[model samples]
Target: MLNLAPELAERGIAINAIAPGGTATDMAAEHTASYTPPALRDVPPEPVIQSMNALGRLAEPDEIATVTAFLLSSDASYITGATIDAAGGWI
Candidate 1:
């Protein structure tokens, strides 16, 4: 995105990305149950999350959606060539 942003900006286009940390999604739920090690999987997500990020919990889908909305809105017109960290202050 950083590379293409300047060129896209010439056409009045914006390119950005979101780096989201752990979140409660179907994919995550499924993966956590099957893929995560048994020891870690059985341990409630709260402590694990606390170790990974400040929020200490998974993000709701709407939390991510709100960031998307803001980026797409006119309020963010000046933002480009950037990655928004919608990770609830994950380190």
Candidate 2:
């Protein structure tokens, strides 16, 4: 994105990306399922998922949505050629 930023800038376009960690969504659920056997499906996945994150919890969909919204808003107009980490400080 940074490589093309200068060129895209002339056209009033901004390019950036977000790296979200451990978000609570269907894709995450499916990935988690592969890590656990069917016999353990009854167990809550929160604890397991939290253990993998520094924040000790998975992010809600709205949390990611908020970041996305901000990126699209004028508040982030000056932000370009960067990848925002929305991982709750994951290690």
Candidate 3:
């Protein structure tokens, strides 16, 4: 999606994709029951856990908000078609 930024800018249309890593939002907590531990793995990874991220912690909603604010403002006028990573190193 980010590769298309230059194209969008050429036509004067701003477009971007928000790539958020592991966030501690409500939706993530509800998906934990879907996994079952396989013997090869011994135990299931952290249940309802977003700990695999580089931060080893859940991301606050405010972090996403800040990215959103930046994306929507005039200050980001030149940042079209960019994928803003709001995740805490979940990538």
Which structure among the candidates has the greatest lDDT? 1
Candidate achieving higher lDDT, 2 or 3: 2
Candidate 2 per-residue lDDT over residues 1-91, each given as its tens digit: 8899888988989898999988889998888788888899899866776777788888999999999999999999998898999998787
lDDT of 1 by residue, 1-91 (tens): 7999999999999999999888889998988788788777667777777888887788999899999999999999999999999887888
Which is the better candidate, 2 or 3, if ranked by TM-score?
A: 2
- A best-first ranking of the candidates according to their TM-score comes to 1, 2, 3
The residue ranges of model 2 lying beyond 4 angstroms of the native Cα positions read 38-44
Question: How many pairs of residues in model 2 come into backbone collision?
Answer: 0
lDDT by candidate, in order shown? 0.88, 0.87, 0.71
Best by TM-score: 1
Pairs of residues at least 3 apart in sequence or in different chains that clash in candidate 3: 21-87
lDDT of 3: 0.71
User: Between the candidate structures 1 and 3, which one is better when assessed by lDDT?
Assistant: 1
Root-mean-square deviation of Cα positions for candidate 3 versus the true structure, in angstroms: 4.1
